[model samples]
Target chain A: MAYIPSMDLVPGVLKGDTRAVARLLSRAENGNEEGRPALEEIFKRAGRAHVVGITGVPGSGKSTLVAKLTAAIRASGRKVAIIAVDPSSPYSGGSILGDRIRMGELVGDKGVYVRSMATRGALGGLARGTLEAVDIVDAAGYDMVLIETVGVGQDEVDVARASHTTVVVSAPGLGDDIQAIKAGVLEIADIHVVSKCDKPDADRTISDLKNMLVLSLGLQPHVPAPLDVGARKAARWQVPVVPTSSVNDKGIEELLKEIDRHGRSLKESGEIVERQAAIAERRLVKASEEMLRDKLEERRGELSVLLKELAARRVSPHYAARKLLTESGFGGDK
Target chain B: MSVAQTKADRIRVIVAKVGLDGHDRGVKIVARTLRDAGMDVIYTGLHRTPEEVVEAAVQEDADVIGISILSGAHMTVFPKLLKLLKARGADDIKVMGGGVIPDEDVVKLKKMGVAEILLQDTPPAAIVDSVRRIVAERGAR
Candidate 1:
């Protein structure tokens, strides 16, 4: 059988065909240059999925929690797609994507799709394919899209900026911690999950997180200046620390309910617009950086030509920079 | 999540075990060999059924499904996986296996659409070359 061209994959993807979704997703992950147009189309058809980002430390039970959360979401009769990200080998550029093992028998379910990603040279707990893969699943008609990060510590906040709702999972007995490595991670969460609530130290973990949230909120109370009374009230969200245990299915439903509630509040309070705007800005900047990198790779010869001209005292740096950008199609002829 | 993919069409294979293949040292070695050869290998650990294996390969969009079995269930395992792959419209993914098996059985399995099966004595380097040839052959088609 011949390969299905990337251009021909868009229709089936738009209609939620699992085969097409799987194929297009592989192309996106590989950064296939042929799939760019189809990706743009996917971007247009997205925005319906409730993309929730879940991050935590290595032993925080993030995968088990994601598996449990997928079950809860599916129980509600919704379609889901999970992008479980693991790190790639920097030396070999090959990876064993074993996230499917912890996903707990989710295979063969038409309503749920689980994909394991390798962060091929991508930093901040995400692969470069992550953002596009989310859009592909979103256009494929999944009601919920869950992104499980590479069990991050502080400064892996890319998941927070990339998601509509960020849930940070902090397990008990992780260490004697000043609230899970202090503010960089704690401040990014729209929801806090204290996993292994069945353990003896669970309460302390919960209380520690609660105290940190309160102290942090007090330190920077209402940083967005002042809006009207209704807007301010709508914008203000009290990030709840939900305790959960995948062991006995404890608090899973409450976590799902809180997720739903957060989704609704964002919509009702008009904060979804602001959140989407911020996400779009981030996407724009990321795309620009990627394109610039690609252009530089494509125009290495042009750079050397400019060097030759400069060595001969023929052209200035400013003129040469503009010439390269124009020739590389960054800006219109001006 | 297959950023597990195409940095210049690097071969992606799902190396798995189906049924009660209680031992896995060979499979683990083969997975590492393929990875060391610059291939992305999704190793689905022991106790997988044909349905589960096919589902994984389809979802992962792998170019091949390499089953390593030593429990003397190759006859039942390979045919069923091929059937499931066909039913799911993913027969495009090549299927192969390795374990202790007789030469005549290898012929029959090959006839039944198993791409290539390496007996126990086959080498690690040959295994890597076979996979590369298999994927390269598929591309040539």
Candidate 2:
């Protein structure tokens, strides 16, 4: 062993010790290698800042839009952190992480921090490491965190869910009415932006999105899904939509102002606390699930034996399932 | 153990993207390759502010930080990443970069703390080697 230290350095992160935050993020992103244990430490010190998620179809200029917004936010004198989530190629297990390329101009600003994350096959469309990445930035004292997801479809929704406010970006004439109508994006956007106004169809796309939002909002509630506990707390409010373009630098500032407005609204209305609570509740559940998952993986050999025994009629399938679940902590009352 | 002990044992590296480049294939590939090679690679993905990447480097206790860029944004992104890295006590981390860097800019990047600039077509082995050598030189310090 090379004598790597434990992840206890996370406490220093809150004090603005950049070294400690970096080590913790490294552990969190790299599955904690020598620093993996820092995750729990990092999580405990998290929850102090606002998180914003940005997603859009590919080439909708999501990254460019984010760049301008973050830069504007920084100029206003707040520390900003960006997490660019890109799709990992199934075949190569690689991601281009090209989103950061759009915001290159902001790369050197002391008030800004940007990180690229591969989705790493996490089912939720966001990278499993993303939550920890956000936490690291949050604990390190960033006033705002912006997460940009590599847009494909529904997975982008999963990425945006982690943010306090989520912006869905779209471009005119790219996918047109069909994309605008997709169930994935319309439902999740707290705000929608029609990017690339320099193009001719930009205004038309904005019109189409507005029309679609009207139709969808009017007909929705059939699902009656429990309101996102946070959404329920902020009841009577609808997410907003705006337009932007990186090419001409249009509407970028307004988009950020909207985010700030939404943040304040949630706070003034007492929904901010509720939203944080909801986020905490969900994160705990996820942590437990991950813990259980690890246990099952650890017991793979015994699980196989149990399965073999069940197949040979040595035990009932139901009993085997129970035993396996119990051994994996699903049986615990706690 | 003391902070010095941690620094000695762990070699931190940051892999970042600089400027209006939305193509991250090279960044991801390099981050994973570096991680598997047993160094801590902190990747700041997409449209990162240069300040953010440098902050990550200093905070992560990186020994060698690499930037991946493809957009013409290199002019803006690289200078910023370098300037902030120097200001934040991260000048110690041997800086290197890759992407569609112009031949003319390579000289400037190296002069500005980028000890190495891997061309777009640089072999993975070379990247791994450059990082390893950088770490080996600085690891025991």
Superposing all C-alpha atoms, what RMSD in Å does each candidate have to the true structure?
4.5, 7.3
* Candidate 2: stretches off by over 4 Å: A1-8, A33-45, A89-94, A176-181, A226-235, A300-323, A332-334, B1-141
Best by DockQ: 1
Question: After aligning candidate 2 to the native by TM-score, how far in Å is the CA of A272 from where it should be?
Answer: 2.0
CAPRI-style class, candidate 1: acceptable
Docking quality (DockQ) of candidate 1: 0.42
Give interface RMSD, every candidate, in order.
4.4, 10.5
Query: Model 2, range A1-334, lDDT digits (tens) per residue?
Result: 1334645576677776656665566566555446656766767877878899888777778788888898889878899988887665454444445565466567557677777666655555576567888988898899999988777564445654577887888888875444644576656777888888888888787877787767766666544534364235324456566877777778888888888888888788777776677667756766676556556656766777887898899999788867888777678433
Distance from true location, Cα of A218 in model 2, Å: 2.1
Local error of candidate 1 at B74, Å? 1.1
* lDDT digits (tens) for residues A10-101 of candidate 1: 99998888789888988887777888898998999999999999998877888899999999999999999999888777767777777777
lDDT, model 2, position A267:
82
Q: Per-residue CA lDDT of candidate 2, range B1-141, in tens? A: 111111113345668766577888888888877655544455666766676666655644567778787777766776776777667656666778888878989988777657788997888888889887876765542
Instruction: Return the lDDT, model 1, position A2.
Output: 82
- Tell me the deviation in Å of residue B42 in model 1: 2.0
